[model samples]
Structure formats: C-alpha cells, structure tokens
Target: MLEGRSCLIPRPPLSSSGDQESTCFYMRYGIIKEGSEEEEEDEEKIDDRGKRRKSQDLVIASSSREIQIEQTPHERNDYSSVEDLIAPIGRDISINCLLSCSRSDYGSIASLNRSFRSLIRSGEIYKLRRRMGIAEHWVYFSCNVLEWEAYDPYRQRWIALPRMPPNECFMCSDKESLAVGTELLVFGKEVTSHIVLRYSMLTNSWSPGKEMNSPRCLFGSASLGEKAIVAGGTDARGNILSSAELYNSELQTWETLPSMNRPRKMCSGVFMDGKYYVIGGMASSTEVLTCGEEYDPIRGVWRLIANMSSGLKCASGAPPLVAVVNNKLYAADYASKEVREYDKVNNSWITLGRLPERHVSVNGWGVAFRACGERLMVIGGPRGLGGGMIELNSWIPDKNPPLWIMIASKHSGSFVYNCAVMSC
Candidate 1:
C-alpha cells in the first residue's frame, strides 16, 4: 500500500491576466525536487512533524566531500489532495472509514482545521458506523459524584468526556441509565425531582434529555434500536410506579407506554429476544418481588414471564447484576460471586462460572456487570482493597470453561456507581 505511484502536482500558472491557467508537475514516488519559493513558504504553516529541513539526496561540498542523504516525501499544506481521491468512494463510506480509524489518531485529525473538527463533532461518523454494522462499543461510567469517563475497548484507554450537566447532579445508577445509539441516557435526579441527561458521543458533552412521563428513581431501563425503555421505579411522591415510557431519539420525544401488570421499583431491565424484559425489584415496602414482565413494543402488551422468584432473588437485594450473551440472559450472584444464566427453556438459573475476585464488593452501590461485545465485563472496586482502586474484568461465556481476565486496574478512590456500553 505504501509503494510508489506517479502523481500530478498542480500549480497556478506563472503569468496571470485575470485568467486561470493550470500547470501540472508529474513526479515519481520517492523523488524530491526543489519546490517553488511559494511552496517553500508554505512549510512554515505546518507543525514540526510536517516540516522538512533542506537536504539533498546527493550533495557535493567545496572540500570535495560528497554526502548522500536519504530524503522522505515533503508534507503538504493542503489536505484536499487526499480528500479528492477519497470523496468518490461516497461520503457515507468515507465516514465509516474514518470511524474505523484509531481513537488516539482522532486528536491529530481533529486538529487539522475547523472542518475536520466539525466532522468529528457532528456525530455523523458514528451514525455511519452504526449503519455499516461496524459500531464499536465504549464502556462509560460515572466514577465520582458528577464525573464520568468512557473506556475505548479497542484502545483500552479512558476517554475524557465533558462534566455532567447541572453541576451538582450526579449520575443516579444502573437502574436508570442506558446507552441509546450514540447517546448515554442517565436517569438521575436533581434532588427529589428526577431528570434525564443525555451524553452525546459525537459532541463529547452532556445535555438535558426529555423528562420522563413518570419522574422516578431506582427504575429499570434498556436500549433497543434508537429508543430506550424505562419501566418501574419509585415516583416523586415516594410511591412505587407501574408506569412505563419509551424515549425515541429520532423524534427527540418520550411517549408513554402501557403500564406494567404490577408496580415495581429498583428492577433490572434488558432488551433481549426482541422484547424489553423487566426483572425483579421491590413490589412494595413490605414485599420484594420474585416476578418479571416482558413488553412487546410492537404489540404494546406486557406478559408475565416465568422465573419470578428466580429472577428477583438476586435482583431484590441490590441493583440487578445482569447481562446477555449469545441472546441468553445471565445475572451475577453476589453471594457466590458467580454468573448465573437464566435457563428460559426450564425457567431456572444455572451457574455459568466464577468471575474474577473483587476488591470492591459486587453488591456495592453502582457496580456494573454488563455485556461488552460477546464477553461479560464487570467493573467495581475498593471493597477488599484499599486506596479507592477500581478494577475491570471480562470473560466470554461460550469459551470452554470460561475464565475471567483482568483487563484494567486503576487506583482511584472515587465511587463508580454505574456503567453502560454505547455503540458509536
């Protein structure tokens, strides 16, 4: 791909009489020629990496010492040369290619000029990635009171995002947060009033999201297509809610859905098998639920599914530690520190395998055990160890005798409460 090719370097004609004349300079690869005075002046505009010092491939000195130097291609002030060749492949394809580029390289690309910055900021590149079936998932977390961070799995590094909106408001928890397309919806509260804040991957900033029809906390949510579904949670009046709603990103609106069969709070929600499944939570102050309800968005109906007791058993105590792999649902058992896959065929819970031992309690507030790609990744910390350190571990269920692999370890004493994956 780096091999030599003949290219034409175009320039304005020397003599101009209110007319445009073009001159073409044909050059072979690996050959450097003395550029025009204007071209030499252009080098000053580029950064040090683009600057090429004067060097001749073959040189003769007055002392009769001949010097041979290796020369590389000179950097150009114009970026259009590459774009002209790339544009013909189609803009959508071009955008997809750009999205596939290394995330760290984005900093340099975005530094090119206003146009490059605008393209990256528009989030269109991510949209194209989704359409092309090449979207990469980034794991985002609210590690501190109001601070949040995203980890690029391919790059295996943290991506800094803008601070949470409204300054004092913090990310609520797993129950109310879900990633819808390129946006992360954080269903948090500004004091007693619940609010939704959307973090846009394209802009790297947070903005106010459409308020939910039923303002609540400790609710269940999940993303399917461009929409997010929110089910049961405690309402503003300190009452449990059965009301449900869907936030459609395309229309930028939230529409009410039929209420669940029963009121529930602090439930676990996941989109699987073409339905939004709301798992166990608190039925009332005196009772913890052992039941679940599945909603068919197309049919607009809720059906009580099997495994009410089995599903709610692990969920009732803390935030539901559930994930999906190969279209099968699984939940983390904090007592055993093992992942249990729900046997839909038999309506039972079976142990998949043990995850990595944790320094933070798996039952800690905001711990996340979610699917990233085909693997289940758990993020939590500071329980068994000191110094507020958080650790990340991942494992694939399909692997023969699944094993937990430690992927990242960061010593930050911040309370990381929730995490979700955003495909962009």
Candidate 2:
C-alpha cells in the first residue's frame, strides 16, 4: 500500500511534458507571475469557509519547504522524488492490459496493503495481485462489445481480458451490470424488451442466477452487506422504471423493495453508512436530472435529499465514484469537473476537489476509486474539457484539500475511476 505523504502542491498537468499543448487544458493554479503586488494581495482573501481563494499562479515547494519550483521543468523534476517515493509504481512503470476497454469501463484495481519495494525498482514486469473478500477474487465489467483492457502498472504495458460470457450480450441490456460485494453481479438484461436475466460472479466466472421480476437496463446496482440492490432504469419497452429490488445472495432470491419516487435510469447508486444513495440520472424526458434521494433498507423507506448544485444530463451520468470517507459521501460529477462530498449528518453536499477535467460520457467517467494504505488512488477516467478517456494518476494530493492527482490510463479513449473502494 502507498503510505500517505505530507508536502502538497497544485495538481500537475497530465501531458507527457508539463507544458500545456493548448488553451483547452487549464491549470487550477498557474505561475504567481512577476511584479503583481495587487495579484498577491487578491490571493490572500478568504472566502466563506475562510480558505484562500484559488490564485491564477501558485508556487511549488518540496517537503522541506526550501526547494521551490516555479514554472520551470528542471526544478519540477526535483519535486518528483517525494512523489516517486510514495507512488504504488514508479511513474514510468508499464502495465498489463488485463482486459479490453470496450467490455468493462471500470476495470478493478486494489491495493495489497503491502508495497513491492524490491521489484518496483528492478524494472521487471510483474503482476502485484491482491485477494478480495471471500468470494470475489477479481471483478471487471464492460458495457461495450469489445473486451475490457487495463494497464498492469507493474509490467508497464496494456493487456485485455477475455470476452464476457461468450454469446451472452451485456451491452444490449440495462439491468445493473456491475460488480459489487465480493463479486461482479449481473442482475438483469433487457431480454425481449420485457424479460431480464440474472447472473452473479462465482470463482472468476459468471453464470445465470435467476431472472428478475422485470426486465430493465441502464439502472444502478450496489452491494451493501448481504443484499445487492438494483434500482431505477428503463424497461425493455424503453419506459423508465422507478421500481427496485434486493437480491439476497444467501437465498438466491429477488424481493421487491419500495420503488423510487420518480422513474429514472443511469442514476449513480452507492452503498454508504448502511444506506444507498441513488443520485443524478435521466428522467422521463431523457434529460439529465439533478434530484437526489437516499434509501434505508432497515427503515424500509426512501427520503429525498438536497438537489445537486447543477443538473447532470444523460450525456454524462454519475458513473459511481460515490465513496464514503469518515462517513461522508464523496463523488465526482461526470458533467462537472467538481467532486462533491455529501454530508449525511447535515443532509447536504460540499464540493471536494475538482477533477482537473470533466468527463462527458459513461465511458469517460469510468474512473475507479482506490486507497493504498492511507493515500487515495483515483485511476483512469477521461481528460480535457471535451471528455477523452485516458488512464491517469494513482495519487491524490492533500494540501490542496480534496486530494486530487492525475495519471494516464492504458486504454485508448477510455478512462476509469471507481468510487467503490473495497478491501481484499
């Protein structure tokens, strides 16, 4: 596991060279500039939270606070020591392409809670595998026809996994097609536009479980405790669905839960604080939505929460990234570069760190959430203002507050950043 580091600096541009290729890519903090007394004063003003506002230019410092790198490439290299020392794999390490990018957008990544000191520097291609919970040893999902691919950071090359359930089509269906708990669970498929198929991951392979009560697709599914919850999506006939169900793995049965107040599909669903949050999705109009809601299984009720600051339309649905840290829900909005942290206690949301870039599609928002020891690793996802998926970064910086870092991905035009941080 990557241990936490202390010194902080603004997120660096992800391009091969730190230099900006075009105005399209902007830095949250740029150079402090020369002889701007007023600009320096403007930087000191505190906003509502008393935190200093973003400055057009910022200085980069080493942990010792002595070495400062201000818009200089060679000087920037000096700071790499601290970053390289703590990274899971050195910045230049190649990785294996476990699966193709088409099948599974959110390729699975986990920390061993142990670091590979000897091999990391040896430059040998090796896979550092971690054991997930009891049942799920590996999990990968793709909604596209092509196989899923991922960079094996240790190997420093790309690799692709086998096609999912040959002849069985996952891309065509809408049911909650994601892995949760210890295994990847495929709940239902939009078969015949009315019927749905049920499947679950067992021993690295997917097999049919049982058919769902109804056929639906493009919905949200999450695993909390022993129950896998499937919620809101469009049915086979192309009608939006508000209904939800719980699949009890122990009993191999599906039981209907209280449906959502509104019919929706593509909403983000994550299990946090013993409850599930289904947020931001398309409505009947097929337009993006900002409404948010929470479901408590124990209470057997659903309660509406504060709406998102802005609407998230279908062009960009919330692709997971909804994680719980210290009991708060934090997620990156696909439509917006902002990563919002939800306050369950206060029933509100606070903006965390900005993504540095906003993803525009389901594939672009495919960033997976990971934690190496104490350092948070947000891998893959797209880049730029236009939504181009690229594998990037494994570390999030802290001094800037929300811990944001950018790294490149192995898959072309596909990026991943999952909020489901799990323990193996």
What are the lDDT figures for the candidates, one per model? 0.63, 0.45
Candidate 1 per-residue C-alpha lDDT over 294-362 given as tens digits, one digit per residue, 9 for 90 to 100: 999889999997554464344336756787766889888776777788878787887767756654463
lDDT (Cα, tens digit) per residue for candidate 2, span 304-374: 76564244344444434454443455665555656666655665667666664433345334555443223
lDDT of 1 at 145: 64
Name the top TM-score candidate. Answer: 1
TM-score of each: 0.76, 0.54
Clashes of each: 7, 50
RMSD of every candidate to native, in Å, equals 14.1, 18.8
**Candidate that scores best on lDDT:** 1
lDDT of 2: 0.45
- Per-residue lDDT value at 238 in model 2: 74
